[model samples]
Target: MKYVGRFAPSPSGPLHFGSLVAALGSYFQAKSQRGDWLVRMEDLDPPREMPGAAKLILETLEAYHLHWDGEVVYQSHRHELYQQQIEQWLSKQQAYYCQCTRKQIKAAGSYYQGQCRNKNLTADNCSIRIKIDAPVTEFVDLKQGKITLPSAIAAEDFIIKRRDGLFAYNLAVVIDDIEQGVTEVVRGADLIEPTGRQISLYQLLGAKPVQYLHLPLAVTENGAKLSKQNHAQGISLSDPIPTLICAMRFLGFVLPKQIETANIDEILAWGVKHWHLEQLPKATQITTLFSNRIS
Candidate 1:
């Protein structure tokens, strides 16, 4: 089968170096394979989204010459699609309604310990959770190798639709990828922990989950991963090639120091020719030189 990969970015803030790595890595991996590479604007959570961040991200990727094959797919416009599948899950009882809040889950240590599993509650100002059973706990990642989830996370019921009446990332991503017919996922390793949950969701929904490749995360000096939460600086789109090349090098590309100085088109052409998905670091957390070194 032909490869179909995607670069999904949440527009909570401007694209930073860390997210750019995932974007470039996924884009190159797909383009290198002579497959369709798509960009998905993961703008589902409207509350935290920055007004211009989506446009900035597109501009940044365009400046880097990472052109996508089709029109960009925005999550907000696909609410009906999400809702259709969500309703299917709801009808089958594969999902259950939960009334647990943040404090309740945190009191049980962040992970949902399934307090409302037997409540059989109605869906009101209530979130929907998938009932995990006899989990297919272990899966093979192209980068991270065999990953096993803790029994707590593996068997624990997880949120699919939030109480606030919006879909959760796990549910939305699975639905979108399945509907988009994505074959492989190449993204940051920080999301590796959620793979098990995502995989479980797909199975319960009777869809084939894409092959996983979790790229290493970029962390800051304080040893925290780059994010708006960590205050990582936004990637300057004014001249994106060098920084993108450096990011590829950080991921262990052998494209040489010269590629780092090339024009955006030149760098992307070289990167597409030389990119290898296997060389990505397998660790869950990695300190990023680009995060700190970029002035």
Candidate 2:
């Protein structure tokens, strides 16, 4: 099968340094293997999404010369597809409806205890959750090796559709990957916890789950992950080459001295020619020094 990868970003904010690292890593990994790299906008959450953030993300990627394989996909336009899958799961008894609110779930404990598994609540005004009879407790990451989660976590009947009527991230991502024919998922390690749940969803749907390679997450000195919610500064397109070089180095790429001064295309070409996945940090998080860092 042809290798296919993607960089799916939420448009809640612009592309920050952390975002650039993921983009660069996934882009080079796919390009290095002579595969296709696609981009998808995870803009399903409108209340949190910035009005122009999607356009800005595309522009910034172009500025850094991280071009995608085809026209970018917007998740908002694919709601029908998600709804169809949800209905199929509901009819098949693989998913159930629950009226459990956030406060109720929190009152129980840190993780959901599947209180609604046998409730058989109607889906009219309730959330939809997959019935996890045999959860996926482990999966091997392409970079992180074998990863195992608590059996309780694996058995939790996680949400697939919210009470607010929006599709959950896990459900949307799995469907998108399957529909897009994604062969490999190369993103940050912060999302590693959800891999098992997604794998279970794939199995329930009778689709082959794609391979995973999670890159290290960039965090601040205070140990907070660099994110738009944390107000991490966005990437600067005004001086793209240096920022590109910084991301390349963050991924542990050893570049020729001449490549530092090269233009965007040249630097990217060098990256594809010499990219090494084994050199990536194995840890889940890597704190970036605030000073002398990519803007």
The root-mean-square deviation over C-alpha atoms between each candidate and the true structure, in angstroms, is: 2.1, 1.6
Q: Candidates' lDDT values, in order?
A: 0.83, 0.89
The most accurate candidate by TM-score is: 2
Candidate 1 worst ten-residue window by lDDT: 286-295
* Clash count in backbone of candidate 2: 0
Tens digit of per-residue lDDT, candidate 2, span 232-282: 888887888777787777888877889998888999998999988788987
In model 1, the clashing pairs are none
What C-alpha lDDT does candidate 2 achieve relative to the native structure?
A: 0.89
Model 1: residues with Cα > 4 Å off, grouped in runs: 108-110, 291-295
Task: Give the poorly placed runs of model 2, Cα more than 4 Å off.
Answer: 290-295
For all candidates, what are the clash counts?
A: 0, 0
